[model samples]
Target: MIIYQSGLITLDYDPATDILFINWPDVQDFLVPEIRQALLILVDHIKSYDIKNLLIDSSRASLDIPGTEYKEVIKEFGHNLMQTRLEKMARILTPNSTRENKVEEARQELRFPIPLRTFTDSKEAYSWLKGTLAEPA
Candidate 1:
Protein backbone atom coordinates (compact mmCIF):
# COMPACT_ATOMS: atom_id res chain seq x y z
CA MET A 1 0.00 0.00 0.00
CA ILE A 2 2.71 2.47 -0.92
CA ILE A 3 1.10 5.67 -2.11
CA TYR A 4 3.21 6.51 -5.10
CA GLN A 5 3.13 9.53 -7.39
CA SER A 6 4.88 10.12 -10.66
CA GLY A 7 6.65 13.28 -11.67
CA LEU A 8 9.71 12.83 -13.84
CA ILE A 9 10.20 9.55 -11.92
CA THR A 10 8.28 7.46 -9.39
CA LEU A 11 8.21 8.35 -5.70
CA ASP A 12 6.46 6.91 -2.66
CA TYR A 13 5.22 9.80 -0.58
CA ASP A 14 4.41 9.35 3.07
CA PRO A 15 2.31 12.36 3.91
CA ALA A 16 2.15 11.48 7.60
CA THR A 17 5.93 11.60 7.93
CA ASP A 18 6.59 13.98 5.03
CA ILE A 19 8.94 11.34 3.68
CA LEU A 20 9.57 10.73 0.00
CA PHE A 21 11.05 7.42 -1.03
CA ILE A 22 12.48 7.67 -4.53
CA ASN A 23 12.42 4.49 -6.57
CA TRP A 24 14.81 4.63 -9.49
CA PRO A 25 14.45 0.98 -10.37
CA ASP A 26 15.92 1.49 -13.81
CA VAL A 27 19.13 2.93 -12.39
CA GLN A 28 21.41 0.02 -13.19
CA ASP A 29 24.82 -0.05 -14.78
CA PHE A 30 25.32 0.35 -18.54
CA LEU A 31 22.41 2.76 -18.78
CA VAL A 32 24.10 6.12 -18.98
CA PRO A 33 21.21 7.74 -20.82
CA GLU A 34 18.69 6.67 -18.22
CA ILE A 35 20.97 7.60 -15.36
CA ARG A 36 21.29 11.11 -16.69
CA GLN A 37 17.56 11.31 -17.17
CA ALA A 38 17.00 10.02 -13.64
CA LEU A 39 19.28 12.65 -12.20
CA LEU A 40 17.31 15.34 -13.99
CA ILE A 41 14.09 13.78 -12.77
CA LEU A 42 15.39 13.86 -9.22
CA VAL A 43 16.24 17.53 -9.50
CA ASP A 44 12.83 18.40 -10.86
CA HIS A 45 11.10 16.37 -8.16
CA ILE A 46 12.99 18.09 -5.36
CA LYS A 47 12.29 21.48 -6.85
CA SER A 48 8.61 20.70 -7.19
CA TYR A 49 8.29 19.44 -3.65
CA ASP A 50 10.50 22.16 -2.17
CA ILE A 51 11.96 19.34 -0.11
CA LYS A 52 14.23 20.43 2.68
CA ASN A 53 15.32 17.11 4.12
CA LEU A 54 15.65 13.53 2.93
CA LEU A 55 16.71 10.06 4.03
CA ILE A 56 18.08 8.45 0.90
CA ASP A 57 17.98 4.69 1.26
CA SER A 58 20.57 3.65 -1.25
CA SER A 59 21.47 0.47 0.66
CA ARG A 60 19.23 -1.58 -1.62
CA ALA A 61 20.92 -0.18 -4.68
CA SER A 62 24.11 -1.64 -6.10
CA LEU A 63 25.83 1.50 -7.41
CA ASP A 64 29.32 0.02 -7.20
CA ILE A 65 28.82 -1.99 -10.36
CA PRO A 66 30.97 -1.36 -13.40
CA GLY A 67 29.80 1.37 -15.84
CA THR A 68 27.82 2.97 -13.02
CA GLU A 69 28.96 6.50 -12.33
CA TYR A 70 27.85 6.71 -8.72
CA LYS A 71 29.96 9.69 -7.85
CA GLU A 72 28.85 11.57 -10.92
CA VAL A 73 25.22 10.90 -10.10
CA ILE A 74 25.71 12.12 -6.56
CA LYS A 75 27.57 15.18 -7.73
CA GLU A 76 24.76 16.13 -10.07
CA PHE A 77 22.25 16.01 -7.26
CA GLY A 78 24.58 17.63 -4.74
CA HIS A 79 25.30 20.50 -7.08
CA ASN A 80 21.60 21.17 -7.57
CA LEU A 81 21.27 22.37 -3.99
CA MET A 82 20.95 26.12 -4.52
CA GLN A 83 17.72 25.88 -6.46
CA THR A 84 16.23 23.50 -3.89
CA ARG A 85 15.72 24.25 -0.19
CA LEU A 86 17.37 20.95 0.80
CA GLU A 87 18.85 21.55 4.24
CA LYS A 88 19.67 18.06 5.49
CA MET A 89 20.31 14.70 3.88
CA ALA A 90 21.31 11.28 5.13
CA ARG A 91 22.17 7.99 3.53
CA ILE A 92 21.76 4.47 4.88
CA LEU A 93 24.92 2.58 4.11
CA THR A 94 25.47 -1.15 4.28
CA PRO A 95 27.52 -2.62 7.15
CA ASN A 96 30.15 -4.08 4.87
CA SER A 97 32.64 -1.23 4.91
CA THR A 98 35.55 -1.50 7.33
CA ARG A 99 35.72 2.27 7.28
CA GLU A 100 34.39 3.55 10.57
CA ASN A 101 34.43 7.23 9.64
CA LYS A 102 31.66 7.12 7.07
CA VAL A 103 29.74 10.05 8.51
CA GLU A 104 32.66 12.43 8.21
CA GLU A 105 33.69 10.90 4.92
CA ALA A 106 30.19 11.31 3.51
CA ARG A 107 30.03 14.92 4.65
CA GLN A 108 33.30 15.72 2.96
CA GLU A 109 32.77 13.60 -0.12
CA LEU A 110 29.23 14.69 -0.97
CA ARG A 111 30.12 18.40 -1.03
CA PHE A 112 26.58 19.56 -0.27
CA PRO A 113 25.72 23.12 0.82
CA ILE A 114 24.20 21.78 4.06
CA PRO A 115 24.71 18.89 6.48
CA LEU A 116 24.90 15.32 5.25
CA ARG A 117 25.12 12.24 7.44
CA THR A 118 25.38 8.52 6.89
CA PHE A 119 23.77 6.08 9.28
CA THR A 120 23.49 2.32 9.72
CA ASP A 121 19.94 2.62 11.02
CA SER A 122 16.98 4.49 9.56
CA LYS A 123 15.56 5.45 12.97
CA GLU A 124 18.75 7.27 13.85
CA ALA A 125 18.61 9.02 10.54
CA TYR A 126 15.01 10.07 11.09
CA SER A 127 15.83 11.45 14.54
CA TRP A 128 18.83 13.32 13.27
CA LEU A 129 16.87 14.82 10.39
CA LYS A 130 14.14 15.98 12.79
CA GLY A 131 16.84 18.01 14.64
CA THR A 132 16.41 16.01 17.84
CA LEU A 133 20.13 16.56 18.41
CA ALA A 134 22.16 19.71 17.77
CA GLU A 135 24.38 19.41 14.73
CA PRO A 136 28.10 19.72 15.31
CA ALA A 137 30.04 22.15 13.16
Candidate 2:
Protein backbone atom coordinates (compact mmCIF):
# COMPACT_ATOMS: atom_id res chain seq x y z
CA MET A 1 0.00 0.00 0.00
CA ILE A 2 1.11 3.57 -0.67
CA ILE A 3 2.08 5.16 2.60
CA TYR A 4 3.40 8.43 1.28
CA GLN A 5 3.17 10.34 -1.99
CA SER A 6 4.78 13.63 -2.82
CA GLY A 7 5.90 15.52 -5.89
CA LEU A 8 9.42 14.28 -5.31
CA ILE A 9 8.73 10.68 -4.29
CA THR A 10 6.18 7.93 -3.68
CA LEU A 11 6.55 5.18 -1.09
CA ASP A 12 4.80 1.81 -1.11
CA TYR A 13 5.03 -1.09 1.28
CA ASP A 14 4.66 -4.80 0.60
CA PRO A 15 3.77 -6.58 3.79
CA ALA A 16 4.33 -10.08 2.47
CA THR A 17 7.87 -9.36 1.43
CA ASP A 18 8.50 -6.83 4.16
CA ILE A 19 9.87 -4.47 1.55
CA LEU A 20 9.43 -0.78 0.92
CA PHE A 21 9.37 0.43 -2.66
CA ILE A 22 10.23 4.01 -3.46
CA ASN A 23 9.43 5.69 -6.76
CA TRP A 24 11.43 8.84 -7.16
CA PRO A 25 10.31 11.71 -9.34
CA ASP A 26 11.80 12.40 -12.73
CA VAL A 27 14.09 15.34 -12.38
CA GLN A 28 17.25 16.46 -14.12
CA ASP A 29 18.32 18.21 -10.96
CA PHE A 30 17.27 17.94 -7.32
CA LEU A 31 18.06 19.59 -4.02
CA VAL A 32 19.92 17.60 -1.37
CA PRO A 33 17.90 18.98 1.53
CA GLU A 34 14.64 18.01 -0.13
CA ILE A 35 15.90 14.51 -0.81
CA ARG A 36 17.02 14.18 2.77
CA GLN A 37 13.59 15.17 3.96
CA ALA A 38 12.03 12.50 1.80
CA LEU A 39 14.49 9.96 3.10
CA LEU A 40 13.57 10.81 6.65
CA ILE A 41 9.98 9.98 5.85
CA LEU A 42 11.12 6.67 4.52
CA VAL A 43 13.05 6.04 7.70
CA ASP A 44 9.89 6.44 9.68
CA HIS A 45 8.12 3.73 7.69
CA ILE A 46 11.10 1.42 7.92
CA LYS A 47 11.20 1.73 11.66
CA SER A 48 7.46 1.56 12.15
CA TYR A 49 7.01 -1.54 10.00
CA ASP A 50 10.30 -3.27 10.70
CA ILE A 51 10.99 -3.33 6.99
CA LYS A 52 13.95 -5.42 5.92
CA ASN A 53 14.21 -4.69 2.23
CA LEU A 54 14.01 -1.60 0.03
CA LEU A 55 13.59 -1.32 -3.71
CA ILE A 56 14.20 2.12 -5.09
CA ASP A 57 13.14 2.72 -8.69
CA SER A 58 15.23 5.66 -9.77
CA SER A 59 15.14 5.07 -13.49
CA ARG A 60 13.01 8.18 -13.91
CA ALA A 61 15.14 10.46 -11.74
CA SER A 62 18.64 11.77 -11.98
CA LEU A 63 19.92 13.35 -8.79
CA ASP A 64 22.00 16.38 -9.68
CA ILE A 65 23.02 17.32 -6.18
CA PRO A 66 26.65 18.18 -5.61
CA GLY A 67 29.00 15.36 -4.66
CA THR A 68 29.58 16.49 -1.11
CA GLU A 69 25.92 17.12 -0.45
CA TYR A 70 25.01 13.79 -1.96
CA LYS A 71 27.49 12.05 0.28
CA GLU A 72 26.07 13.80 3.26
CA VAL A 73 22.59 12.65 2.39
CA ILE A 74 23.76 9.11 1.97
CA LYS A 75 25.60 9.24 5.24
CA GLU A 76 22.59 10.54 7.09
CA PHE A 77 20.28 8.02 5.49
CA GLY A 78 22.68 5.21 6.26
CA HIS A 79 22.82 6.22 9.86
CA ASN A 80 19.05 6.24 10.10
CA LEU A 81 18.72 2.91 8.35
CA MET A 82 21.17 1.35 10.74
CA GLN A 83 18.62 1.78 13.46
CA THR A 84 16.05 -0.23 11.54
CA ARG A 85 15.67 -3.81 10.41
CA LEU A 86 16.94 -3.07 6.90
CA GLU A 87 19.05 -5.94 5.61
CA LYS A 88 19.17 -5.23 1.88
CA MET A 89 18.38 -2.52 -0.63
CA ALA A 90 18.07 -2.70 -4.40
CA ARG A 91 17.99 0.26 -6.72
CA ILE A 92 16.73 0.31 -10.29
CA LEU A 93 18.52 2.90 -12.33
CA THR A 94 18.59 4.13 -15.89
CA PRO A 95 21.51 3.01 -18.02
CA ASN A 96 23.84 5.92 -17.38
CA SER A 97 27.45 5.30 -16.53
CA THR A 98 27.86 8.58 -14.73
CA ARG A 99 24.85 8.01 -12.54
CA GLU A 100 25.85 4.42 -11.89
CA ASN A 101 29.32 5.53 -10.86
CA LYS A 102 27.93 8.18 -8.60
CA VAL A 103 25.61 5.67 -6.96
CA GLU A 104 28.45 3.27 -6.34
CA GLU A 105 30.53 6.03 -4.88
CA ALA A 106 27.71 7.09 -2.64
CA ARG A 107 27.12 3.54 -1.48
CA GLN A 108 30.75 3.16 -0.61
CA GLU A 109 30.82 6.44 1.22
CA LEU A 110 27.73 5.58 3.22
CA ARG A 111 29.26 2.27 4.26
CA PHE A 112 25.91 0.94 5.27
CA PRO A 113 25.90 -2.37 7.06
CA ILE A 114 23.19 -3.74 4.82
CA PRO A 115 23.85 -5.10 1.38
CA LEU A 116 22.97 -2.75 -1.47
CA ARG A 117 22.82 -3.41 -5.21
CA THR A 118 21.88 -1.45 -8.31
CA PHE A 119 20.15 -2.85 -11.35
CA THR A 120 19.07 -1.63 -14.77
CA ASP A 121 16.12 -4.02 -14.88
CA SER A 122 13.21 -3.91 -12.46
CA LYS A 123 12.62 -7.65 -12.69
CA GLU A 124 16.22 -8.38 -11.84
CA ALA A 125 16.12 -5.97 -8.98
CA TYR A 126 13.02 -7.54 -7.48
CA SER A 127 14.42 -10.98 -8.01
CA TRP A 128 17.47 -10.09 -6.01
CA LEU A 129 15.41 -8.47 -3.32
CA LYS A 130 13.15 -11.53 -3.08
CA GLY A 131 16.14 -13.84 -2.81
CA THR A 132 15.31 -15.61 -6.05
CA LEU A 133 18.79 -14.81 -7.31
CA ALA A 134 21.80 -15.76 -5.28
CA GLU A 135 23.75 -12.92 -3.77
CA PRO A 136 27.28 -12.34 -4.99
CA ALA A 137 29.97 -14.12 -3.02
Candidate 3:
Protein backbone atom coordinates (compact mmCIF):
# COMPACT_ATOMS: atom_id res chain seq x y z
CA MET A 1 0.00 0.00 0.00
CA ILE A 2 1.08 3.62 -0.57
CA ILE A 3 1.59 5.91 2.39
CA TYR A 4 1.87 9.63 1.85
CA GLN A 5 4.21 11.20 4.32
CA SER A 6 3.04 14.65 3.31
CA GLY A 7 2.40 16.87 0.35
CA LEU A 8 6.09 17.08 -0.33
CA ILE A 9 6.62 13.33 -0.72
CA THR A 10 4.96 9.94 -0.56
CA LEU A 11 6.22 6.42 -0.09
CA ASP A 12 4.46 3.57 -1.85
CA TYR A 13 5.62 0.47 -0.08
CA ASP A 14 4.30 -2.72 -1.61
CA PRO A 15 6.07 -5.36 0.36
CA ALA A 16 4.01 -8.05 -1.28
CA THR A 17 5.42 -6.95 -4.61
CA ASP A 18 8.73 -5.76 -3.19
CA ILE A 19 8.57 -2.49 -5.06
CA LEU A 20 8.96 0.99 -3.61
CA PHE A 21 7.12 3.79 -5.37
CA ILE A 22 8.60 7.23 -4.78
CA ASN A 23 6.62 10.26 -5.81
CA TRP A 24 8.60 13.45 -6.06
CA PRO A 25 6.78 16.48 -4.73
CA ASP A 26 5.18 18.90 -7.11
CA VAL A 27 7.33 21.99 -7.02
CA GLN A 28 6.25 24.79 -9.32
CA ASP A 29 9.73 26.22 -9.23
CA PHE A 30 13.09 24.75 -8.48
CA LEU A 31 15.30 25.82 -5.63
CA VAL A 32 18.78 24.39 -5.40
CA PRO A 33 18.96 24.25 -1.62
CA GLU A 34 15.56 22.70 -1.34
CA ILE A 35 16.41 20.04 -3.90
CA ARG A 36 19.57 19.22 -2.00
CA GLN A 37 17.65 18.82 1.22
CA ALA A 38 15.08 16.67 -0.51
CA LEU A 39 17.72 14.41 -1.97
CA LEU A 40 19.39 13.91 1.39
CA ILE A 41 16.08 13.16 3.00
CA LEU A 42 15.21 10.72 0.22
CA VAL A 43 18.45 8.84 0.58
CA ASP A 44 17.84 8.39 4.27
CA HIS A 45 14.25 7.29 3.71
CA ILE A 46 15.25 4.71 1.12
CA LYS A 47 17.93 3.35 3.42
CA SER A 48 15.44 3.08 6.22
CA TYR A 49 13.01 1.21 4.02
CA ASP A 50 15.68 -1.06 2.57
CA ILE A 51 13.99 -1.06 -0.76
CA LYS A 52 15.52 -3.02 -3.61
CA ASN A 53 13.46 -2.06 -6.61
CA LEU A 54 12.39 1.57 -6.92
CA LEU A 55 9.89 3.04 -9.34
CA ILE A 56 10.13 6.83 -9.34
CA ASP A 57 7.10 8.73 -10.61
CA SER A 58 8.23 12.22 -11.59
CA SER A 59 5.27 13.21 -13.74
CA ARG A 60 4.06 16.11 -11.62
CA ALA A 61 7.52 17.37 -10.72
CA SER A 62 9.90 19.73 -12.43
CA LEU A 63 13.62 19.95 -12.09
CA ASP A 64 15.04 23.38 -12.83
CA ILE A 65 18.18 23.01 -10.81
CA PRO A 66 21.47 24.52 -11.93
CA GLY A 67 23.84 21.89 -13.23
CA THR A 68 26.74 22.66 -10.91
CA GLU A 69 24.71 22.68 -7.73
CA TYR A 70 22.82 19.57 -8.74
CA LYS A 71 26.01 17.78 -9.57
CA GLU A 72 27.55 18.53 -6.21
CA VAL A 73 24.56 17.24 -4.26
CA ILE A 74 24.18 14.17 -6.47
CA LYS A 75 27.85 13.42 -6.13
CA GLU A 76 27.69 13.66 -2.38
CA PHE A 77 24.83 11.16 -2.38
CA GLY A 78 26.35 8.97 -5.07
CA HIS A 79 27.33 5.48 -4.11
CA ASN A 80 26.77 1.87 -5.11
CA LEU A 81 23.04 1.78 -4.31
CA MET A 82 22.04 4.99 -6.09
CA GLN A 83 23.29 3.39 -9.26
CA THR A 84 22.42 -0.15 -8.40
CA ARG A 85 19.09 -1.70 -7.33
CA LEU A 86 17.24 1.30 -8.72
CA GLU A 87 16.37 -1.02 -11.57
CA LYS A 88 13.88 1.22 -13.36
CA MET A 89 13.87 4.98 -12.96
CA ALA A 90 11.23 6.40 -15.26
CA ARG A 91 9.78 9.90 -15.58
CA ILE A 92 6.36 10.79 -16.93
CA LEU A 93 7.07 14.11 -18.56
CA THR A 94 4.90 16.92 -19.80
CA PRO A 95 3.77 17.21 -23.40
CA ASN A 96 6.14 20.03 -24.33
CA SER A 97 8.90 18.53 -26.41
CA THR A 98 11.43 21.12 -25.35
CA ARG A 99 10.71 20.58 -21.66
CA GLU A 100 10.88 16.86 -22.15
CA ASN A 101 14.15 17.27 -23.97
CA LYS A 102 15.48 19.34 -21.13
CA VAL A 103 14.56 16.63 -18.63
CA GLU A 104 16.30 14.03 -20.77
CA GLU A 105 19.32 16.30 -21.05
CA ALA A 106 19.45 16.67 -17.30
CA ARG A 107 19.21 12.93 -16.85
CA GLN A 108 22.12 12.49 -19.20
CA GLU A 109 24.08 15.18 -17.40
CA LEU A 110 23.57 13.43 -14.07
CA ARG A 111 25.00 10.25 -15.59
CA PHE A 112 23.40 7.91 -13.11
CA PRO A 113 24.55 4.31 -13.36
CA ILE A 114 21.00 3.00 -13.60
CA PRO A 115 19.02 3.10 -16.80
CA LEU A 116 16.69 6.11 -16.89
CA ARG A 117 13.90 6.81 -19.35
CA THR A 118 10.96 9.19 -19.77
CA PHE A 119 7.40 8.56 -20.90
CA THR A 120 4.41 10.70 -21.68
CA ASP A 121 1.98 8.19 -20.23
CA SER A 122 2.34 6.88 -16.70
CA LYS A 123 0.54 3.62 -17.34
CA GLU A 124 2.70 2.82 -20.32
CA ALA A 125 5.78 3.75 -18.36
CA TYR A 126 4.76 1.56 -15.48
CA SER A 127 3.95 -1.33 -17.76
CA TRP A 128 7.30 -1.04 -19.44
CA LEU A 129 9.09 -0.99 -16.11
CA LYS A 130 6.97 -3.64 -14.46
CA GLY A 131 7.00 -5.82 -17.57
CA THR A 132 4.30 -6.95 -19.99
CA LEU A 133 2.46 -9.39 -17.73
CA ALA A 134 3.18 -8.46 -14.17
CA GLU A 135 0.37 -9.72 -11.92
CA PRO A 136 -1.59 -6.77 -10.64
CA ALA A 137 -1.75 -6.06 -6.93
Each model's lDDT: 0.59, 0.80, 0.60
After superposing all C-alphas onto the true structure, candidate 2 shows an RMSD in angstroms of 2.0
Q: Between 2 and 3, whose TM-score is larger? A: 2
Better of 1 and 2 by lDDT: 2
In the range 1-137, model 3's lDDT, one tens digit per residue, is 76446546677777765566777766656566666666666666666766555666766665565545544554655543464445655566654455555545555665667665566776766666666534447
Model 3 residue pairs with clashes: none
The pairs that clash in candidate 1 are none
TM-score, structure 3 vs. true: 0.64
What candidate 3 gets wrong by more than 4 Å, as runs, is 2-4, 63-84, 96-99, 133-137
Q: What is the lDDT of residue 84 in candidate 2?
A: 89
Q: Which sections of candidate 2 miss by over 4 Å?
A: 27-30
**Residue-pair clashes per candidate:** 0, 0, 0
Taking every candidate in turn, the Cα RMSD to the unseen true structure, in Å, is 4.5, 2.0, 4.9
lDDT for 37 (candidate 1) = 71
